[model samples]
Target: MAARTVKRRHVSSRLSCKLFIVFTVSIFCVVVLVTAVRRNVPLDFLWGAFFQNGDVSNFSIYVHSTPGFVLDESTTRSHFFYGRQLTNSIQVLWGESSMIQAERLLLSAALEDPANQRFVLLSDSCVPLYNFSYVYNYIMVSPRSFVDSFLDAKEGRYNPRMSPKIPREKWRKGSQWVTLVRNHAEVIVDDEVIFSVFKRYCKRRPPIDIRKGKLNLKLQKQHNCIPDEHYVQTLLALHGLEGELERRTVTYTLWNQSATKTDNKGWHPITFSYANAGPRKIKEIKDISHVYYETEYRTEWCHSNSTSVPCFLFARKFSRGAAMRLLSDGVIDHFELSALLGNE
Candidate 1:
């Protein structure tokens, strides 16, 4: 009787130990599965949760066409005029909607064509420094992951003019002017959550009516939300696709010139001359080559010693009177025009 009792107790203890091990293994498996699913999910689904019914692949390139209270019909016409000249191999997304709306448009376009290779977003002032063939070949031959590096939060963060509702880990920064891959573009356009968060919290101040002496104190307090930096950065970071960007844009600009002028002022004519080089003049081919080689040319002039320099893919504010001079100066070739226009 004593031996039988001992064997029964041993069996019961062994059964209990087996059950405990099985429970622990099951919980671990569940945790790993959940993490994998979350990481694999598309950003569009997460952000565009509010609007679930749009085709995303119809368009390939996105152009952000907001002429914020400046420039004339000629400038606007120039963009379209030049844009239309490009071959139709690439689909161009153009609209004057708010940043959020523009993103939505991009999302709709992406859904319509998942296989689309490249997306270039441009402003009205932007011109194709190179011909369409060069641009097209650049898009087709470059690695699909070139745009990913720019989208990563680890790369850079946008200035939060207003507090964001989404967590900071999900934020990123890139140029308003960009060339993106189709998948990455879709992620940005389809993001519903990030856009809503920005729209609600990022307030854009209305233009203040300034009278001669009396300041309108009430207008000063109004929060104006400008979507240029924060809008694109936040959405890209959250999607984990930032690593795919090239960390550079192809547009060029001269920001230093634009800064000296007043806001809402008409475009000023900028001439690139050896005389105009200021204190830091590029005197020889070496100097010119050094500046061009060291600097990364995107939509703006960046990586220069002067803060007054304008950083853009295209510089505006040129006096209309100087337009003819600009066209004739042949300065465009100095801007690496040959490289961009290569074989196109």
Candidate 2:
């Protein structure tokens, strides 16, 4: 009887061990599946040298590429963007409320990591003029945030839609690309009242002729909501925030024209492609050194001033092809990005 009991006990123990192993493996697989996979690295060949010596602990990248962007490591250099992609990205529409939503989503995600001292938003087209460390240290030690918020006398800047909740005086315009400290970033994402008001009234009026697809004449007379530019600027202006707000941008953009599409007035930045990314056109991109500062004019919220730094850390509206052109045409070398990198 004792011998028989011992055999049964041993068999039971073996079965338990096997079940435990299976359970452990199942848990490991689940963790791997659920954990955020975004590595947030840059294109290896392009940015590999940037990160080669820089301490990884100093920065984190979170990208919100448009949905359905496929990744093929062979050509696309997609590995850098891997695991760095945000799953909560929204379809951003031009001059629509959804634009603000996307910005908030990015800010909210970055805020969770306390180590992120400063936040800057960049489109896929944006490329660094300086090395990663230079950009990092420059922002860390800076006294003010860089947002180009101004009041343009141009008709489309301020509308009556924002009245009691957001005074006309408080309404302001700035570049959509912005950088903020932790406090300001938190202030932007946390405010329900201000952003809610901007959402309700800060949208382009529907076209008067829907079937004809023509812009509304009356709508053209009033300001269209570019909330990404207005919301944070207005909030900071209203709260009497300063010093922390420099009202400028580190990202250089050619608001004059787009290479990919021809803006009728030459108001939008040109997108670069092989056809237009040549030296002559690229020279124009390199020459945008003009900077603006706060001014007293009723129409002009910010103006060209002597104090604005000529250092443009990044430039935008570059198509992926444009980025390659920059690399190919020795534009990156001209910017001295290689020489400036990792020096700190």
Candidate 3:
């Protein structure tokens, strides 16, 4: 009689516990849905792009678009759209500390689910060169991070004003579009000491010249301290996380100067236009065997202080039309998107 009663009680307790979990998850889902409809950009096309060669469940797509829009009407039709958009979305300004803040926001949101192992940050302008499985396996198998971190002391990249707080040896710069591991992501959010200086002192402002009769706007140069580029890279290097640095971006950005108009010059990569797509230009870009670099700029290895890594995986600054052209012109097709998925 005692054994039977005990068994019965255990069964009842297990059932009740499962019921409690299910009820809690149900409420959490409701909250996430309400949050999705509130703020954030509609990543409809970006979502579709990721799943072009594989299922949506394979990856989690998040967009930090400006001019936040209502996602309620859009999410109504689609089940997958539920709880994917992020709340606490930030307004991103070019070459400002806000850029770094927005990145932290994405990291914080994605870090909520421990299932997300590798987090790839991309802009709406960015596109995938390889299909799903290739990207997934490639990033997952790598032991090091794919961030472009290098020291550029001479190019006005390091700020002397930030001296004792941020020492000369610690200043670093690199591409903001990067893939970070969970540990690195946590470091970014939990960081307060280094990030505070950027929020207050180091600012990149617009240039102006208003003479007696002429009103002229000299173009905005690079930020006094590009926090997004500097902060993450410097933190990793300063903390002796140097071995884990891949120092090469998967995204390819053209560094050549444009032939058209020369005004408001900055460190802007050439935006390959869809209009520029031709047999000649297409041939030039297809020769990806050689990596492109600005004639005047170089990022030498700080470890050995000698080597430079090649670009791999994807390219950036390509116009939407240019991306489509790569698809239509058979660059992406030439890579054989289907091989990513084996016969399994």
Score each candidate by Cα lDDT.
Answer: 0.32, 0.52, 0.51
Off by over 4 Å in 1: 1-97, 144-164, 168-174, 211-224, 256-344
Q: On a 0 to 1 TM-score scale, where does candidate 3 land against the true structure?
A: 0.69
Could you estimate the TM-score for every candidate?
0.46, 0.69, 0.69
**lDDT of candidate 3 over 1-344, digit per residue (tens):** 00000000001121111100000000101011111223332222332344455544445545343434334444322233444455566555666787777676666666666555666766545555555555555666555666776665555656666767778787776677676766776788788877887787567655454452233333334345566667788777767786776765555566554433345454466777778754465444434433222321543332211232224555556665676566555554443323322133
From the highest lDDT down, the ranking of the candidates is 2, 3, 1
> TM-score of predicted model 2?
0.69
Best-performing candidate as measured by lDDT: 2
Off by over 4 Å in 3: 1-49, 71-83, 211-223, 256-264, 277-310, 330-344
Worst 10 residues of 1 by lDDT: 21-30
Error of 3 at 60 (Å): 0.9
What C-alpha lDDT, on a 0 to 100 scale, does residue 237 get in candidate 3? 74
The CA lDDT at 48 in model 1 is 18
Q: Give me the runs in candidate 2 sitting further than 4 Å from their true place.
A: 1-49, 66-78, 207-223, 257-266, 274-290, 293-308, 329-344
List the pairs of residues colliding in candidate 3. 252-315
Deviation (Å) of 277 in candidate 3: 4.6
